[model samples]
Target: MKLFKSIIYICLITISLCSVAMIYGETRQSQWIDKFIDSFELTNSNFKFYNIKANMMIEKDIDMNELQNICLLIAQNLTNNKDEVCLKTEKSQVYVNYNDKNTGISIVGIKKNAKESYIIVDILNNKVYKNIENIYTKLENELSEYSNDVDINVCIAGEYTKKLKKAKISDILQKILYNMYAEKISDIEEENFLSVNAYSKLLKENNLKYLDREINLNIGIRYSEDDDKTMIYIATPIIKIDY
Candidate 1:
């Protein structure tokens, strides 16, 4: 009977450890969002949120076929039997796009690499802030089942109907950085675009280095003629989507 009790205790401890590993990168979502929203509010641009997106990369030495199948399963679980389109296929890559129009959930998956397969999952939605948090939390939980070592990037974007000048955009970026008490590591300004890379001790998420400086905040702004609006993207670590 003592041996049986010991075995049960071991199982319980194992399960608890697994649970902690699964939620590796989830504790800072609310903080990140609040910072993003509050910083943007400083601009006083009165922009409307375009979307909240998450890009997650899972790296493990798995076969391309296995990665593709896993991506398919993840999409199905995300969209609940929605139709998915195979966007592209190459010798070493497969891209799938899943859109559940009714739910406003768009998921794109890609399995690519010549030597070792890596999976990229992009999930986007224009829902309430709480809903966005819930969606990505579920996604992280699901992806953790496959690989504990996953890298995630979450971003929120907003747009103003009027186009702003390059100087104006730069001022906006500076305002946001100052509001967040972030250290500006690097910045670029083009005729129609402006971006700044920064680091802040207030953020409790992952960090990457650029030119020997730690960076966790990324702010970008550009004018889009297609939408007749000026777009702004704020992300932690970096922005993955094209401006």
Candidate 2:
């Protein structure tokens, strides 16, 4: 009986040590995520994430299926772990929770453009003005030709700036993605929609006050050499807004 009791005590000690070790490991991961977020100069209001998880409010009328696909694509493309992607929708915004296994990065997607369209990005851990400036510089260099035709506006929302100072990451990822889309789509055939002509036609058809609101255009293309078929999904946020 004495020997059995001694063995049980030793097992209990072993379990306690294992539990402590596990907790420490989780704490370390959380800290790494927090640090990465802080590096982006994030604030509490513009974005808030705890334990690298966040909850957002999305409208009930929003398309959850399309949001999920985009979220999944982002996770697959940017993060090391695909299994970490989790999503839930509320009345106003869809909440996405995922850990950057490589960097403990947290991200959220807000505001859908169309059925499966959303603006999203990793929550920066610190102020992103420098990063934003870098992007702007790159845009200026790349868009030299369009400088005459296009007026580039770099407006940083006050709230976003405040959040950056507080080390809360916001949705700059969406902006970066949009910039990338712009670059890629511009290289595609000019005959596609969203050429200057298309924009003019859309504006005329809708009788829109184009100056009042910003327009976001997305053109998705998938080409199959076997069938000689190209599938294109062009999404214009302004058009959706008018509808």
Candidate 3:
């Protein structure tokens, strides 16, 4: 049964990209960010992650100077150490870079374009010299402060490649399957089929407890050499991400 569940989860990971389209009310970029965060959150309590790049475009151009100041302020709020954040101006861009020497986590912000503007941030997960809250999450919260004006079109590419681990995938799969099963049974109401949640509820009545955890997932986009159309893969490789 465990092997079967593991196989099912692998398939689900491969197919999840397509299945996610049915989900409404969230932008693809935001969903992608959520998945990025979820992968780390599931494995460790305080694992830090870095970003490759994200787009933070506003409806109209805001003052570039003001925006750079905001980035500096956000960095200050996250740290007590002075000189941790250094500011610099390059052609058509202003940068705010943070170096957390204690934890080796660097959060960087970029404001681009001369007349119009947008923000690109890279969350670099340098070696975990110490435990710290994830940098992307902090910067994400900072972005929310300007939500009224900015049209967030953040997308990221992996700078650090990861090796997928099957054991980790299988462990997280149990939770994903249980949650999905619960949702299915609640809406469809099959006559003979009982959801894992429903069965767990029955066990709870008899003083036994069965509970499920949530899995953070994103759809895998697979391109095929044989076919022109790209495919969705739910059974994704479990990977260890590092710089």
Top TM-score model: 1
What TM-score, to 2 decimals, does candidate 1 have? 0.68
Candidate 1 at 230: error in angstroms?
Answer: 1.9
How would you encode candidate 2's per-residue C-alpha lDDT over 153-219 as one tens digit per residue? 2222212221121111113323333332322222233222122101212212122233453344332
lDDT of each: 0.68, 0.36, 0.40
Q: What TM-score goes with each of the models?
A: 0.68, 0.25, 0.41
Candidate 3 C-alpha error for residue 169, in Å: 4.3
RMSD of 1: 4.9
lDDT, candidate 3, residue 240? 16
Candidate 3 residue-wise lDDT, 41-99, digit = tens:
44332233332333455544566577777667766765666477788876556677666
Question: Candidate 2: TM-score?
Answer: 0.25
Q: Which parts of model 3 are misplaced by more than 4 Å? A: 1-54, 102-115, 125-138, 148-171, 176-216, 219-243
Order of all candidates by TM-score, from best down to worst? 1, 3, 2
lDDT score of residue 14 within candidate 2 = 100
* Per-residue lDDT over 125-201 for candidate 1, one digit per residue giving the tens place of the 0 to 100 score: 55444455566667777777877666667676777878986577768877888777788899888766788889977
Worst 10 residues of 1 by lDDT: 101-110
